[model samples]
Target chain A: MTRMFYSLLLLSSLALAEPGTVIRKTDLRDKPFLDAAVVGNVSSNTQVDIQSRKGAWMQVKLPSGQAGWIKLLNVRTSSGTTSSSTALANVIKTGSSGKTVTTGVKGLSAEEIQNARPNLAEVAKMSSYAANSADAQKTAQANQLIAVQVPAFANSTPTTAPGSNIYQERRR
Target chain B: MKKQFLLPFALAAAITASLSAPAHALDLGKLLSGDTLSKGLSVLSNAGEALNTSVKGLTPEQEEALGHNVMANLLGAAPLMNDAKVQRYVNQVGLWVAMQSEQPNLNWRFGVIDTPNINSFAAAGGYILITRGLWDRIRSEAELAAILGHEITHVTQKHHVKALISSKSQQAGSDLISIVADYNSSKSGAKAGEKGGKALSEIFVRGLDKNDEYVADVNGMVLAARAGYNPYALVSVLQLLGSVNASDSTVALLFSTHPSPQERLDNIDQVVGEKLEGYADATENTKRFNQVKR
Candidate 1:
């Protein structure tokens, strides 16, 4: 009975241990072009779930579940992952809502139209920011960030309202 | 034949001695006989002739040299604006407006000085300077054009030249001394040129009359309007002057020399209203202005 209890305890300890624990935070380069090249950036202010480790590089899953190698410093083994995932989900949801309004193309309310103008501006601003950051080789999620932002803004602003189109054209 | 030549030569020598004898001494016949002025200098020849008759001083060469010295000093003191695009743009705008002036003489050179002073001045020989501070504050190109037109008039009318000549005639050696003193002051301010000449130049620059300013204002406004700029730009710029600090004594002097801003506005309103009352709304200059920072 004593031997069986000892064996059971060992098994339970093994079960609790997760595979490939990552203990550093990493940031994905916001520029899509730089996302793949290590020359562009490293894991920014984000932690990762370590899928495996290779020498100095840790192959980990991004918050997006995309796999990439990060320097050891950029990820840490923590419960922050769940909150980050939730935030990401919220971003996607909000972004989709915005995109729906922007792509609606035909009918929009006055408030929606007014709000959409800024959304377009915000999108343009993000694109410009991404371009500059990319040139500087800085890690910026500018495109992703703007992608999330533009739609939410477009939804809030209706493009179908009277005189909005004119304003929109001028702004563009 | 050689004896006849000697007679003329002897007469010329006597003429030269008589002209050099007194401070106001001049051989009027000899001055009129010889075409001492170079080509294109004839525009100023008659005036210089009349001026010599009145003052009876300064040889033709001296007058030419004075004009040349003034122009050289102007060029040396005022460097062209550094920014290529802006410098080019200003020159283009200035030249366009200048072409409309009564006397569009010389290739108009425009530059922005890196000073916070709300001032603009046109030197003899088509040197137009507008301070960056003034340019930045202007809300429209029309205002700039109007101001440029005004400065262009100052140059074309030879206002500074006339002032210099007057000072020389009245004060004799004091004019040269004052010029040296002015140069000294500018040097103390670390400005270009010797302090004395600079001082004289400043004085001369400051001596523009009220009528000259009014004529410039009127002509400038008309030029701007004809150039497709909003005619109201002149009035608007004058009004803007009230908001910004006008501590630059030259700028204040310029305004004082002109009709009051209110007076100018009234004149413009009357003239433009009468002529362009039924005209279409001016095409908004949003596009032209977008290229420039001010």
Candidate 2:
């Protein structure tokens, strides 16, 4: 019964489809793998509804109602709506008022940084919360986080190619 | 030839003396007198040469001190959030991610400032702070690790320190002298603190080079992956940020300081490609994160 409830919960979460746009030309695959059968071809700037994510792929429904998996990075999710609309969407989607609760509270602005005065006391307070290396290791162990040996990428400047697979050469 | 060389030195000395100790300002005439001028020029020339060499790098101790000063100034802008639990949680996550960095032994400290600004800061040494606004937006421990990993790369790469050095080199003599003067005077009064704060603020407001930010993005993913967290957590966070309206005041400073979210995502895609796909199933720790986040 509990498993059924959890499955229902998962379904409810996936029901909230997010809007996204494919930023490049890519193949929509029947399965979430590089060698998977291609179901369709999505061109740059095609709008779609993102259904779910699996590893480096996202399951999305194209405007023509075709559902398939695309490379996650190829699509840009749309959350660029105006604040009021976002707040309204959050209310309907999350069943809560959202960030509007803190609406009137002032946030840090560029001008505040410009005329800031040093607050040494707060800095001192921040120090008291510092975590040591052993403690950090303990936290990692408790969470079953094993350290891995991923290598550094070759340092390069940003280039204009969006779909270029230049990183393949640097992979060990 | 000698006078021509000495003239700029005399002006620098006059300016330095006036700025560092306004009460005992040295006149250009006094600086130009034969014995005094020769001795002062020799000292100033030696100092300028030292500054030139030192501009290439700072000692770890020097970097820590500068970071401390910058952190204090940042606190002045927005004091830390008062919740000890949240502060402690952030530190644990941050230190764990930072341990995967090259400089694992550095004294790492992390905090969440009280402001609602959607941004994070990385000072020279190992100081990292995320604003409450950004903090509230984070969904899981993996996401927090990814963000902290990004800031940690900034420190490990010495992006801010290099920026400071390059900016100092641009001003060469006078600014270097003033900084030394400021350090010496910092021992006695708040005046030096005020001056340092202003200088640090200008850098923070202007933000780092776009290329440096891009480098941090890619390296941050590597760091998170090394720490056994899903590298895609950062992509999710960026997607969330991209969804926010650009004109929102909460993200005003962040948007100005960073490339637009779409641009950053595009750059990450171009750079990282499929290298991190293997680690996508690493720990997300959503349950513990949700429990502690409240």
Candidate 3:
């Protein structure tokens, strides 16, 4: 029953073609691989329908109805505005009733922070939930998380060609 | 460079003269006199050497205390969510991800603040807080891990601490000393707490250096990958953030404090490019995420 529910969830997610724009010019590959054959080209700022994501590749359908995979980083998905009803749905979905609503009801504003007084009691409570290194390691092991060595700030060189995108001037 | 050296010397001389003079009777003429000036300068030179030794960097204990004080002030703005399971789950995930950071052994604490503002915060010495609104938008554990990883990078890099030191260093010579003193006295009362709180809030309002945010984005993705999660998770989250309308209140603070989502994405793309593509197949752990998230 749980498997079926997840399968349905996956299907529904795929069926919803999220609108996105190619933020940078990228090749549309036949498969989600760098070595994969380039089927087409999606230019910078071209609108596309993002069908689904697999790893770093997103399967997107171009305006001409051609579908192929592109690097997920090259595209920006349209923001699905979180209207009141969606917010209400999220609240209900979390299974926390209306009684707990008071806490997160208002948006946290700068003015609120500037005038706020420190809540030492809440700070103390948060401390109680702190996780130690050993427990964290145990959780990692349970989750089958294998530590990988990734260099911090690995690349300092800019790889993208100049004038490739709108942020070119801002690039260091 | 000459001004930098002379300012500290002059300030230190002034302090030494004030300490030696009788209470409520600072003799300015006597202070400027050759004898008193020489005496104060000699005493200040000794104290300056000691101050230099202590001012190298905040000790680990001091960083933690300052972080705790900042965390308390932030909690004052938005209290922690009253849900132990969610809190514990976030801590476990956050800590596990943080273990992959350079400062793995710091006393890491993670809390989900009960606020609708879609933002996350990282305090020095390993205090991370994510808002409930941000939590609600997270789709998978990998996404959660990525956000936590970004905040983790800030702590690991001592971003906040460095920012604090540099900002304080801009003031008179006594400012840095007073910050250290403030942290030392933070244990006592509400007055100290208020001061520390105001300083942190101002930093949050003014925001970190834009380059620091970009560095966090790049390093954060690397950290998530190190923890064996999909590195693209942060890209996905940024995509989500990018999709939100600029006028939306949920992301107002985040937008104000961070580089625009599109700019962040572009910055990450410039640095990361395809380096993390290899780790794309890493786990998202959506099932466990959903279970805990619900």
Candidate 4:
């Protein structure tokens, strides 16, 4: 059954049909650039099967089997999902000490985080990355980035009730 | 504390004595009848007020500690990118943007995590990390500054603190408030503290509320502009993300955790549309960015 499934997966990848919907009205061109002859216009919400990508354009085939490229940003993948949720379990491997140890994946899965012990060593390591206010100020001056106060917010009236510890400079 | 309430009541009694003495005699008699119940209720109300004050979000110190733990968990997933220059560059750019925020003195540290996933994180305190993949994709410092600006807003606004309480709304009550209140002293928590700690780490997995994300987007632009970087860099990056194939594995993690790039682009555009003088004159610094990135 596993062999059958692997073959089916390979077959599916060979004959792909990843449908996506257009996000906005953009030109469907013979080539990826705007200079190419406009084959047609793929209006917003129009569906197209994504084939491949050029620099910034997605090559898609129309339902009528005519293939062309569309601006990559114009479409949303129909079946594509962002599932970085904690589904993968903790990985266990044998260490040099000849004992098994549990380590997490490259990007933590949620379960691994829930079960993993607190890493104080890692916490201290990140702290070494700290840049103090003075050092930060130097970076600004070097870049010629002057601090300009944008008076969009009401400085006098804070958004939240100012706690005793909150440093509020009331120019009022 | 009782004396404070007595002063107000004494003044009120003095004022009412002149006009409503006869009327007050009847009211006073009624009050005396249930004086015990009223006094108990007043004490309870004051206790409620005290609890409300205590539940107010973390002090900067507590927030700082929370950010460290959260950042540690994130680093556990992806270690810090081993380039000191790159890390230093992120800190300088991020700190410049943060200095203009409300919490200027926050221990703002920026890191580039060594991961292929294209995602940036903002914790409760001023800890932020942009993955190496996202760093490589950005073409200019202004764009990077804009991204940091958005994440910094999350910190300044205490979105992570609020998110911890919110995600546990089902079992909310005093226990929820206790998690926020006791978050300051890491050792002060019971099982509630344990739950809150778990939730804080889970922030990397569970993104903030959509409204909070939008608020960060708009305000981040403002901060980025104030720091003298082109504010529209955020929008341009949003457009770039929108252009990337949604099914692409590099961006799949980002795609799940944030509002659709199209939605964020439209929402943030509304914020950028609000005219502020000289924002157009903001710097993009494409050349310096390319050099630093290299």
Best by lDDT: 2
Candidate 2 regions off by >4 Å? A1-15, A35-38, A82-103, A156-172, B1-56, B165-177, B181-190
State TM-scores per candidate.
Answer: 0.43, 0.77, 0.77, 0.60
Candidate lDDT (C-alpha), each: 0.42, 0.71, 0.70, 0.60
Candidate 2 residue-wise lDDT, A1-172, digit = tens: 9999999956854674678889889998999888999999999999987787766778888999898999888888765643635533433432232322333346678788877877878878999999988988887788788889888877642232222223343333
- Ranking 1 against 4 by DockQ, winner: 4
Query: Compared to the true structure, candidate 1 yields what TM-score?
Result: 0.43
Model 3 chain A weakest lDDT span, ten residues long:
A157-166
Q: Which 10-residue window in model 1 chain B sums to the lowest lDDT?
A: B1-10
Tens digits of per-residue lDDT for model 1, A86-139 = 323433443353321122112112122122211122212211221121321111
Model 4 lDDT at residue B127: 86
Itemize residue pairs with steric clashes in candidate 3: A79-B243
Cand. 4 Cα-lDDT: 0.60
lDDT of 2 by residue, B1-294 (tens): 121222223223434544454332222232233342234333565343333233233566556666777788789988887678789988888898898888998889999987766899998779999987787777778889989998998888776744443322233234445655655444422454455545655667777666667778888899999999888888878887887888777788888888888877877887787879998778876455776765
Residue-level lDDT of model 3, residues A1-172, one tens digit each, is 9999999967875666578988778899999888999999989999998787788988888999898999998887665543555554555654455324554446788787777877767877988999888888887778778788877664432221111222343455
Minimum summed lDDT over a 10-residue window in model 3 chain B is located at B1-10
Q: Model 1, range B233-260, lDDT digits (tens) per residue?
A: 5654664453233333324444543555
Q: lDDT, candidate 3, residue B206? A: 59
* B11-99 per-residue lDDT for model 3 (tens digits): 23434544464341322222233231234333444332333322223467656656766676788888887888889999999998988
